[model samples]
Target chain A: MSISDSTILSVQDVSISYLAHRGKVRAVSRVSFDLHQGESLALIGESGCGKSTLNLGIIRLLPKTGRIDQGKILYTTRDGRVVDVLGLSEREMREFRWAECAMVFQAALNSLNPVIRVRDMVYDTAQAHGRHDRVQIRKRMLELFRRVRLDPERVFNAYPHELSGGMRQRVLLALGVLLNPQVVILDEPTTAVDILTQRTILEVLRELRAAMGFSIIFISHDLSIAAEMADTVATMYAGEIVEIGPVEELFYRPRHAYTLGLLEAVPKLSVGAQELVSIPGSPPDLIEPPPGCKFHPRCPFVTERCRREPPPLVEEAPGHRVACFESARVLAHSQPVR
Target chain B: MEATTSPQAVQSGWAAFWKATRRALTGYTARTLLQGLLTIWAVMTFTFVLIRQMPSNPVQIEAERIVREELVSYEEAYSRAASLFDFDPNQPIIEQYVEYLAKLIRLDFGQSITSAGTPVLDQILQYLPWTVFSVGLGLLISFTIGIFVGMAMAYWRGGILDNVVTALASILFGIPNYIIALLIILILGVQLKLFSVAEALGRVDPTIEPGFTPEYIGSVLSHAILPVVTYVSATVGGWILTMKSSTIATLGEEYVTVAQARGLSQWRVLTAYVGRNAMLPLVTRLAISIGFVVGGSVIIEDIYRYRGLGKFLTTAIVARDYTSMQGVFLVIAVSVVVANMLADVLYGALDPRVRVGKEQ
Candidate 1:
């Protein structure tokens, strides 16, 4: 609600859409969030929930068909200068990207150019931002690689295919922070690796964030990861942020039915022998979604008014917001699992 | 203990040698080389047997021609034809095969049958350079231009460039090289009056002496224009289409997006990321095309009356010059085989994924 001086990236009424054959599919609609300096925000949602689109929209790396329909992505530079990312010229945007804000994409296995060596990619990223000193870049890269637990020299010289899935992810993470970007957007960084490797990546990410002090906005379907890595968590459903707050506040005192459904769907360790409750029906079609509340067809607390009108996002608690008419009832019904 | 160990050491040494030899024989490069060599030999033998079985023997065909043209007696024509040609029609096929095989081992193609004592190797060497220069230049020009045009088309897909070039490339790709050459001659030479067909015939003008002089080079290029144009029109289509699809696929690759997200210059991403990867699949295709450069375009060269290796081949086949045909076939087979081997090596060098015997 209130923007502080430390707020690095603020997405105000952002909307993204893909021009499809049938019609324009609104992928992300009016998604607003503030990512403060050194704070990690995780956008949690099911598949096709536009979690990835919002993050990609911030960096302006959407596919050809995908476009930012409306939004003001305000990025604060280190000098406290507010620059509209949408307003930056192509040339300025190129310099702004990776230098000001970098994104570690999904599918780490395919993230790197297979033909190129890691060191060349490192130099390329640095040189693109006008950092021409090779020795300094190399030294910084080697340090980052070491911090990520990779054999610095070996990984530096090796091709993308030469490294394992986890290694590539780490290399990408290290590369993502190489430019010392104030904001790093990670989209499902741990999805393609094994469990142990996932743990390592998380630890490395934490260490990097701690050491470098950069704000992170990560997209994850894994609730545990969202719980562990995120300082602030935003629950996205049907292209809209339904609930968002402090990690503990959102997870424990979920004020939206969709968020409650998500938390209940996950099989809890403490609550043994309980049946996992999956939300009935699939996600609504974006082209011609149901009128009024998009979640009403699937929401348990759907009232007569729900089908006729959409609920505006309102603050249910200090620094916590939810978009539901029956937020108090939903919060009262939510039982703490841990 | 020393005596016992000595015998064991000798056995191990022999085992190690055998292992090394087996490894060399079965390794990727060695296997590819061996297969290529075998393929060449197979093609050579097939062509040798096949060309011989075509219609009539050189001596008999020549004798018939002499009798019909000069109104000579059959016996006189036969004797003259037999004497004129270095071929002995009475010689057993088995004996001829054995002799040919023996000479082939020594890398000697023997004398030309039609030209009598002229060495087949010398004739081929004289004609080879013109073909290589013309065809090689055509391919280089087409490939380079196609790559840029194709990438541009892909980048601006659905735009006017993509739509126009796609249709044009498809149409050009469908037409045969010889037909294209004839069309160039008909449309450009006769209808359009772009260049005189008579002047364009052969590799160079008779007055232009062989040198690195501007006049000589100019004359050579002028003569080469028709065949080179034909080659470019016919093959550029294939390159453009191939490169377009490859660029499209490479553009969709995650690395390309990542490269952009890294704030890389558009040129760097296009070259190092998109262009390099897109060009990989085409590299082998290009290498194979290079192999055919040695063979030259027989029909296209003949149509243009260009004195390249292909024209030489047409002459040899017309005269039933067995030795000359065999010599040309051998050269073609060797070049193709060598080019394939080079493709494998070059592919390995360009792409580290297929680099043989490297750490896995």
Candidate 2:
């Protein structure tokens, strides 16, 4: 509803599903969000919560089984033209990808062709978009590689197998923004690397974001990473946004039982050795989910109303939304400040 | 000078020399080549010993044939056979082996027992080129067609192309080369009257000079068509199936998806990403196949009446000409060994992860 001139990507009521032998698996159900220019929005959730599926839907790069059943992904081009990505023809979509929006995949190690040199892949990306200036592409790629803190020349000429995991991740990140796209979607960029490498990647990402000024849709299960990298956080439960707000507000004053439970589950450094409370039971099956509020089965503050009816996403504050019947109770228990 | 150079120093120098020699002998490429040569020798020796163990020697076999057909006495038949043959049947087997080994060391295959004064090496050389031409052409055509069709099948997997080709390729793969040759001759040549079977016999037209002229080349190709078709039909299915599976696996790789996500053209993705990666495992297979080109298909060549190395091998075996058979077998053994070495080297070149002599 908060559509503005600054908004780069407006995803409206996006619902995606995957066809299976049993039935259709509703991966993401009527999800909606706005990503403003230069803003980093993190979609945080447990595995199989449709975080990745939703992002894949945005690029229209879903698997053969997956379909964006309903949604309009309105993208604002640099020339001030708004294009519905879903309506773009195959040729136009090919042109739009990486030139307007790029995705840095989860498996960074396997995201590059092993037989090909890094420079060739860069050339390939450029050539695909009708950019034939190899010298210009190389110079720009080398510069981007340097920004990502890689040995630019070595990495540029080297094959993917020659580079380490962290280096490959950085190479992919550099390659992602080589076209200077308006949006970059990163799906767990640091998951494959060591802790030190993860720290380096985060730093490099922050620096790159500051320099390039592109909006980001960061998907991760690591709350700490989400907190560090995201300006706004959206907690997903059973393929729906259970709670979404500014990072600080969501961390401090969570208005959803699932959000509060997720925070409680994470081991706090300050409260060393305190028994970490965990949310009981697994995520509900999207194929045939439990009726009413999907989280009610595992929610601590479950009520009769919560089980009987699914709560719609409603604004609890000026900028915060929660889909829980017991928002007031969750908000009260969320504060750790004594 | 002796005082300055201590005994320990001289000893150490000799030790270093020996260490260098040891390293050279044990190095990967050197080791591989040595193993290949040893394999060739072993196969040659085994064939040599095995063929002599056959029921009849060349002299006795020839004599019996003469006696059966000409109504001559056994003593008269034996004298006639002895006079016709260049080989000495009375020589001890051990002495013959030693003489063969000695001549082989100098690359001499000796004279053919059945073919009077013709050297086995000369006859092999004459017949080898025809087999190479036919089999090589077949393999090349088969490989190319298989790669494209297989890749196409994989890219559009589960489609009509996929379903039909999968069934067809599997069927073709199961059929033997000789059977395919017979089928071609029977169905196309004899039954269909597509081409005259008599004209297809032999490697080239007797009237045409074996040169690069259009007429000569045309005749050569015309003659080679039947045998080549047989080779392609027999082997193409294997290549197609292998490439299809390889390409399918490659298409599933994350990098392929990433390549498409990068907005690469479908053609580019097919060739550079999917095709190149998929073709990696096939390079070794192709090299091994190339090795077998020299050995050729004996039955297929015989059926087509193509005068190839395989045909020569068949005739030598029939005549009980040990020297000629040994020569042909040696060529096959050498080619197979060399091809295996090429496979290893080719694989290293294609896949940088397994590049030779780099990893400890």
Candidate 3:
């Protein structure tokens, strides 16, 4: 199970805390994962479940009050040097950010500089990182537009608002992979797009990622999309990754009680809902999460052990990891939902 | 719809010429210009009617002057007064208004009834630029400084610098410009003796010949300093607070985050992304602010004893200078309309989103 040939980065016990008005809210707690080169890791969870935080945290794009409270983010450079992302100076981080890893932000189509042309927005990002050869940049930009199945001339000169949501999402995709980065973190890139546009974005991203051979941290709340797009799936609850495994292993043989409850909650196609079980409560109170297993209060199979102490994420199968005390009992009793 | 994109079609220059002409005639620029002209005409017409209704003592003043100095009979004085305005006392107010409009079209604001024989147009020309110079310079200083300070405050939102700036903005907004002008004169003119209460009064010193010399220009600027400072200080707070709040909102936008994530330097992100977006509303406001330069700082001019249009307006009212009042009001109204039009056109150059070619 050790990372080999494609290992690009490892998020080791990285905890992130945000200074909200109410109090300190731990958005991501001691989350750990290995991101293999050219592999896609789908970070799936309900809303406010730290999936987005993990993406932002990996790129060091946390807001003004958000801080990495503990642990190292060991990022593998293009040249295969492992540098602690947290330990690097801001200046060094700047060089490493887009050149090595970039993110296609969530609901970002509307956020395109409404005043700037699509081409200029991409150029600005390219030029900001000291790429001065305009002709080369333009040539590459046109090529990228083509790769995304967009005509550069038709859309390039037009301001962002002039384009449809689908076109705008493609532009964002182009910008994210502009430098052919080794790693791409997509935070809900399909959140605001129509279904047709979502399929197009997925196709373009899959094609581009295949051609470039880049690792991706795909963060989404939709379990169906994650099941389809990601190689490995990490289920997050109450700011912690409660279960991590290959998509099939997690979906079919969910060992964690939260994962079992989550899989059961999703409505399957070609079938009518008889009793589609739902998670009992909303996402845990971030400011004052329940003690021990943060999910214990809302957990369906809550035992005394779950309320007393937090269970460590331990490997239950060859490639599956779970953090529930009753994972074994739940896995035996819970039927496969998908 | 500009659907033709074939390179050969554009090679002849005919298509280009046609497009350019079409854009000018049927696009946003032409539409906005029409709107601006309509607005200005409406303002001029409204002011024309309103000024005539204002209480005027000009006929009384002229009649009294004839009786006291010329030793004329009261009846003779009355006839002389009635004839001077070219209006019959028995005619309706609307009839007088129509007559006034006819003369206004001919560019004849009849000679000031109270001042006798001096043209209202000439007096307006003499005082208008002084007000423009003071108010325009004041607006420029305040807008630039306020925007910069506001941006910095937003960047350092919770810091001590932000608190200090917020407090200062509150003080500026709370106090009126005239009060600030009074304080400046009372303190700087009376106590500190930084500038003379007398020297800083009027457009220029009485002794200097009104010529295009360095000395005359220097004297004119010295007179403007106090009023300009007061106007800028009083108005700057709103600009700062608006810009700060707008920038704060912009900083949280997903684009800003995406911009930063793309490895842009913090400075580049701040100016090109965050600052540019935050400034769109302020750009329109800047145009409005410049328009007010023509409005003049009436109370500030009064406090400083400066001879600008605002002061001229006050004098015209007291002496019942009807033509002069009408002339000044028309100028202010026209300038404000023109300023708004300029802003609408400027939007084409500033924000690309609004530069949409033709109306749907």
Candidate 4:
């Protein structure tokens, strides 16, 4: 570990499962990661790879059927004390949820109140946390609108239905950081917006993170955007972290075959290609995952040892970890850089 | 797109509207108006046959009873019974039916032989207002209480308040309306000494003279209270249960969850998003309830001895008075049809999704 600073939020060995109709579906299995102060960590995975489920579990917002089979999520509160989030009662959770940690959901347009104006929605969070007076709250809202590069007069008085998708997202971003919480979770915030809007929103997020100094948990399946935005990256497969390291290290020197396949699958703009390269085969079923290492059947470098036992996540270098027995061989076999 | 003012476009738009209307009406062909009318005709015909098939012919019973009760001669009694019942035993069944259809077309329901020669239509018109007042008032009260209480229960889901309200609704819903009415009569009328348990006709006491006065109006209202309460208590549970379930389902929608995640207060989310959407299903149920209210309660009216249409129907059945029975049936049929039509119009007004004037 680099030991830059203490982890602001630590999730230890979190495992969640849901009692589905067929059987128990393991959503998140022993997923562990830490979010440091003022740094962004991206959880990248395909659908059903447990990225969203892990986020829900961390916030204790999982649905009725889902249960945290094993895990502990510890957060450093504003009072300079760490507490387990799962231990709090529902009422206490409500009090701590938006005040200490807020979340920006994926569908921002539908997330806002259609009946009330944007000003009321933002003011509601401020009032809930008792953060500021009416005048102060309005002033802060205007400042946030300007910071997000939205017109305060036009948007503050408009209902959610009246605003476009990008504008609504900006409003949601404003609401999320209104209380200036220590941590904010952005769950695929840019998925529904256009490409230019996505870049603008990401830029705004970077600016906000710099000025506000709040750590971010950016959850997305788009690895390219994640690489561009995240400092640290965790790649998940079948509800388990196959690799985790600094973004640059993971991108330049990925050791796991699955990680390498994911990186190669991203279509490069500079390369002239008639078609994009896609990873063959689908994700493993979580209800009854493949025996031993779940990715063995999908891996091109599968061996008898890889099929017999799962490889634990071992550190291959400083801040670089890979969960594959042939990591050294895979790195040795790659072509030299130009 | 360019605005089209061509004749062809206008014709096509009209054609589309008519097609949509026809599709909506005939898509459910078995439940269409023609099918419903046929069913009504069959039921009325069966009722007519059943009444005539009863032992003790109306003409003979009336003649014999008049002779025995009034000590009149057979000849005089026979003439009086024939004139009152509009009957000649010599007439054939086919002829009678033809006359019946003709009279029906003319809106002539004949006279009530059992009610001392009163016209059957007049009797129905006389009792119509009392039924409307009592049942309509009861429905209003029940709906007001049911919707609000159900909303409250849904808001505090799984709490003690929800459990208690649900339990109460279940108990009330399980009990029959007559049983409820009887229980109320015993409690409020016999024990508490409040409000009259009987005398549910004419709006005011005939003994007080037929002019509007504060005392008369007060007595009329007081007389109406027991029946209204009884009817409301019997029917309110169903509305509450329905509204509660609908509200809970609405609360589970993605929109409601999104609203809450947007940092809306519990009340704002409940009222604006959950309540508004939940009310759509409740509005349809309420429309059905309104239709039933005009038809009146058959059991509750009987228990309270209220001379509403339901009570009159029962009396007609027992007396074997065919004219009076037919009259009561027609009144109820018309009332139900009109009530349902009114509900459909109101539904269209309330829900913008329902398009009106697309059908003749």
Q: How well does model 4 score by local distance difference test?
A: 0.78
- C-alpha lDDT of residue B330 in model 2: 96
Tens-place lDDT per residue, model 4, B1-360, is: 346567778899999999988877776432446655665666667777777887766677788889999999989998888787655666787787788878888888888867756888888888877888889999889988988989888878878989998999999989988888877778876788665555543345667755578877787787677779877888889889988999988776755665555445567667777787677777777776766774567777777677787788887777677778877776666556556655666666655446445444
lDDT per residue as tens, model 1, A1-338: 33579899999999999999999999999988889999999999899999988887887889999999897999888997888899999999999899889999998999999889999999999999988999999999999999999999999999999999999999999999999999999999999999999999999999999999999998999999999999999999899999999999999899999999999999988778899889999999999888888999999999988899998999879989999998877888896554
lDDT per residue as tens, model 2, B309-350: 999999889889999999999999999988988999899888
Q: Could you tell me the TM-score of chain B in model 1?
A: 0.95
Q: Compared with the true structure, what per-residue lDDT tens digits does model 4 show for residues A67-130?
A: 9998788887766677888888766676666666778888786676555567766676676565
- Chain B TM-score (model 2 vs. true structure): 0.96
TM-score of each: 0.97, 0.96, 0.91, 0.67
Q: lDDT per model, in order? A: 0.91, 0.91, 0.83, 0.78
DockQ of 4: 0.17
Better of 3 and 4 by TM-score: 3
Reference contacts recovered by each candidate, as fractions?
0.88, 0.70, 0.73, 0.12
Regions of model 4 farther than 4 Å from truth = A1-6, A113-120, A149-159, A332-338, B1-241, B255-277, B296-300, B308-360
Stretches > 4 Å off in candidate 3? A1-5, A270-273, A335-338, B1-37, B63-92, B106-110, B356-360
Ranking by DockQ: 1, 2, 3, 4
Residue pairs with backbone overlap in model 4? none
**TM-score, cand. 1:** 0.97
